[model samples]
Target: MNAPEAVNETDAALLAHAQRLTAQAGRPAPKALTRLAGGRNNQVYRLEADDGPLVLKRYFTDARDSRDRLGAEWSFISHAWSRGIRAVPEPLACDRAEQAGLYSFIEGRKLTAAELTPGHVEAAIEFVLAVNARPRPALAPGSEACFSLAEHIATVERRVARLATLDSEVPHVAEARQLVSAQLQPTWAAVKAGILSGASAEGLALDAAISADQNCLSPSDFGFHNALIDDAGKLTFLDFEYAGRDDPAKLVSDFFCQPEVPVPLAVHEHFIERLTQGLGLDAASVARCRLLLDAYQIKWTCIILNDFLPLGAARRAFADTGAWAERCAAQLAKAEAKLELVGADDTP
Candidate 1:
């Protein structure tokens, strides 16, 4: 990623937008606006003001994918704040017209896989439980939230189908095409079959949706990947763009399946039991999580290869100005590694 062009903290339009939002929030104009990295779908910056530090974020907008990222994140954080959840940022101000929002800056570093400890895992579990302690009407279902096994399978199938459309002569694209056709497609077929068959064996209906009470507030892309450890050793979760009501099973699956800052599989059982027991989830929900792990694993493989798609490439380009061929090749390798985790039999 090229910081000069990609972030461009000096960009007049962005600075103007930030100034407007900060002024509206009753703060001194930022003496310095520094762009922050780690955001893949939006622009984030740290603003230093006379009072303190604040964060300004510009949500990504595209005709092809419109999910109201700004609204979702603002509403989710507001809800958590209202419930006395301090593990999230304070929602300070928003400029919907600018597709931007301002929040309390978090001084922290992204948690890495190597630094993960059981205490950290417990903190994450507690955070989820606290967030879901009660429900509110303001929140909507999470982006692409699936209620049934059939819906989950359909979502993955659609992603795989999109990847199958790759038909280019470029070296990286050509290699991706072969991987999709030979590995991804066949792996998805097997995973789909296994999920359907396993659901039947477990007496879980593929089309039947779980009751509303079973739904939990999910940080859609939940994982250590989205968490930061502050200077004081408190963990603060970020990126609620896809946060809202979702199947707890899906949340659990994504927690373990997310590749970045991967949570250790050794804690999988403890994590599941603690979350289920705390949230009062039924045994069937636990079974669903276990049975659906492979499906999610396959889904993540398709997600990792998104660099080959038009919209995916566009998002990547916006976030990181890397060479296309290099990124595509790296993503293909990641997808292959993720695919290998599908049947490693570590499902919780």
Candidate 2:
């Protein structure tokens, strides 16, 4: 694990960055750096140093939206540890200029969907409940008190629209472009109608708003794919770059969305039940989840749809064929089925 990473120009730059971080924190320079895998938004490395193992995450400069994602994550993890919560990686040194931070690596073998058991889901449920028990005001980006489902939907719509702007270099890109275009509107309408129905029945106006009480600070990319299981039989959640006060419903939905972690339907039910029970959710929360199912389903449709976009193809780093294409085809059907799940023209 201490093997030195090859010093490419990028690696050399990271070395300098790491040196600065270590010197600033009064620690020895790292002995080696190992680039980690599977990040689409950030470059991560495991650094071996005299002080022990530290993880460095460098933010992506080309993120679609301009915001201090790095700063927000630092706030989330730092505050969590400040309050004695350590299921997350302990935040260490960071340099805002480099958009990189070091953390104490909670050593563990990252788990895959194949290894997912009810026990793992139970542990994950317990961890999230505790993590969300407190409100992290520092992590909030704006005056908003909670995550906005309407805003999320709007963003997804915009991204789907942007797909048209990307040149269709691959066959999947063209197919996905057509699919998303054909379905996004109807899907969104169904979702909105459901919410309206839920609200109208309760004699309230349809509101796409969720309060912090109904949400929590979430590691937005949370899933078994982003978590690890240590030898001690403990699970650790990873990837907080997208972490912030978010709709709890979104959190659970994202967890189940990852293709790499295939959570069974039974496990999904148990996790949801335990989470709802743990949160002591009221009627509003329950209703919110129901309405949110539409958005989450739509979100996943948008997510897998990305593999068809030019940028998505580039990020996927593979040609749109064979297994990848098959995966896309499956996702396309699944996404379309979402609309059917709610029924056509069916008012929410």
Count of backbone clashes for each model?
0, 2
Which ten contiguous residues of candidate 1 have the minimum total lDDT? Answer: 1-10
lDDT of 1 by residue, 1-348 (tens): 112233455677777777888888888888668777666788788887889988888888889997999999999899889899999989989998878999998767888898998999999999999888865554798987988888888888888899878636333888888888999899889988888888889999888888887788888899988887977789998999999888888898899899988887767778889988888888778888888887888888888887777787678767664566776778889888898887775644
Candidate 2 TM-score, C-alpha based: 0.79
Computed on alpha carbons, the lDDT of every model, listed in order, comes to 0.83, 0.65
Number of the predicted model whose TM-score against the real structure is largest: 1
| Pairs with steric clashes in candidate 1 | none
Worst 10 residues of 2 by lDDT: 339-348
The deviation in Å at residue 208 for candidate 1 is 0.9
